[model samples]
Target: MSRLRPVVAAAFLGLWFLSLPALAQQEQMPPPTVGVVTLQPQSVPRILTLPGRAVAESEAAIRPRVTGLVTEILYEPGTALEIGAPMFRIDPTTYEANLKSAQAQVTSAQAALTQARTSFSRTERLLGSGTTQAQVDESRAALEQAEAALQSAEAALTLAQSELDWTTVTSPIAGMASVAAVSVGDLVTAGQADPLATVTQLDPIDVDMYEPSARMLALRDDIGDGRLQLNETLQATLTLETGETYAATGELVAPGFTVSTSTGAVDTRFRFDNPRRLILPGMFLRGQIDLGTTEAFLVTQNAATRSKIGQLTAWVVRDGKATQVELTDDGTWQNHWIVTDGLEPGDTLIVDNFAALSEGATVTTVPVTLDENGVVREQPAPEAAAETAPAAE
Candidate 1:
């Protein structure tokens, strides 16, 4: 029995020793797979994004000068109208009768003046032939009174003609118009506060946007140094929230002289040729203005992480080990970072598996591509980037 017990104990010891190897193997296994990126320098755009609103280049409110019931509406919404074209027809019968009465009065005054002139001529001859002076004077006074009456009648006739024309509401300017208020047969009183329609010149429209004052100052410096083009119009495209592109190129108008106190931004104007009038006034649009060449740093966005102190940080790989780097404040990239500090050239940055990573940890390195959402993308090497740069002529 003693010999059997010794053999059993030896077998148990052997099994325990075998299990130790497996435990060590599990501990030595690598961490989970993650994405990574490298730090490098490339040209980045120094663009300032801001909100903007569209407005018409020229607009006129169509209102009536005289009061009457609307007889007809000759214009429709989105219709193009010419200058002096009749848009609304008011009741003109009343105005027409007034004009006719004024004309008759003018005729009656002219006949009285003719009779007075004939009497004056006779009186003048009698005075020269030794007729009574009192009679000649009285005849001269009657002629003068008749002349004043004729002038008053002519003034009245002109006023009546003007009122008749007001019954036909004509467009003051030539352009595309919008139906604001009223339809056919709607009573439209003259001198009423409300407008009948609104006309806008849509071929060339304006967009007003605001940008930070700091960005504007920097842009001005870039322009002066030829790093950016200034006072020159650039082709711009507007993207609506619905992802539609407005089919027009915009020109940069003048920059605003006043800066906003609340936001510290300056209003800037842009002019776009909207020949089709597809863009409506008061619509919001996203504008892209390309200010040529700027000095910027380029690094993968994955490499940038935020520190507990509310600062952006990155895990820069140095000598095959991870190191924490706090990126500078002035940083931006298309999907990367134009870091100001905490990074140098030839540094490899980790883009994935950062939560469990610790300082000085050794990691396997790999190149990573950034997707549109700035997430790490493991991809094969790009042939385009591998091509040698062309020599400067």
Candidate 2:
């Protein structure tokens, strides 16, 4: 028993001796290294993303003016058309005959007008020579009646010419043509209830963006307090259904003054140039409008944690130690938090290796930067960065 006791004691002593070195190594190890970005006040763009719908700038429904059978369809469906371009031709046979009849009447009226003037001149000459005053009066009355008939005939002729021209239905505006609702040989009436076709102007398209009224009110307050500065020009960019961004930048054409009763939002209209006809009417889209600039710290979302109660907190290196802070952010910008408060300039915002961080713990910070794509990358060394920099002009 004594021999066994001594062996156990010796074993314990050797194990303790072995663990002492490990304990000392752990104590001597340096603090965890974390990548951080130094805080600087930058003019970050304040963008508001909203749902929008594309609308045509102008649209027209084509209807026949002259009541007749549709003889020919002049315009091709889904093609561009200019103002006064022919779209449908009504049967011009009846219209042509009516026009010819009007022409004959006009000629007859002119001939009668010439004869009446000559007769009136002769009556005036013979008024004092073997011509009674009563007879001259009758001649003058006849001339007047003939002149009135000519005027009436000319007015009818004008109407006939107009009706003939109306036989060829032309476009009232320049736009893209839609399919014909009525086919050839179909009888149509003037000012009918149904349209024969449609034309839509789509090059310079309009987008109606709905913005929440509450958010707009918040923006107004922020702007009033000088928390945000408006841009010189209001612009917006669109994201298509396929998640591709549109190439054209839209301008604010109309700002809403009335709120929608059903949506709790206001409709702001934007105009965009779509020469390729990419945007059509009634297409739902996503748009990000450049509201203005606000002086705020942009913190990466990964560095921040939100509490169950919706409180945002992040770890930042302050005085060479990790410090926890409660952040007040307006919203997210580019997948990052637009922190409006609870941070100071020159603070080191720990981005990576922060899960293991604790309050008041010493931290080693490595300067890092976010690229154009919001990707975290270690900052280039001073000499290497200088070498890659563009030369002075």
All candidates: CA RMSD in angstroms?
7.4, 5.7
lDDT for model 1, on a 0 to 1 scale? 0.78
lDDT tens digits, residue span 165-212, model 2: 999999998999999999988999999999999999998999999999
Tens digits of per-residue lDDT, candidate 1, 1-393, equal 988998999999999999999999988988544466665655566554567889988899889988888888877778888888888889999999999999999999999999999999988897858778898899999999999999999999998999999998988888887875887678887678889998888768898887788988876776787655443445456777687877777788786999998989888889998877777789888877665545545666656667678788778677877788777644454676666457777777788888857888777777777777777767766676466557569
Model 1 error, position 113 (Å): 12
Q: Clash pairs of candidate 2? A: none
lDDT of each: 0.78, 0.92
Best by TM-score: 2
What would the TM-scores of all predictions be?
0.65, 0.77
Which one is best on lDDT? 2
The CA-based lDDT of model 2 is what?
0.92
Residue 354 of model 1: what lDDT?
Answer: 82
Clashes of 1: 3
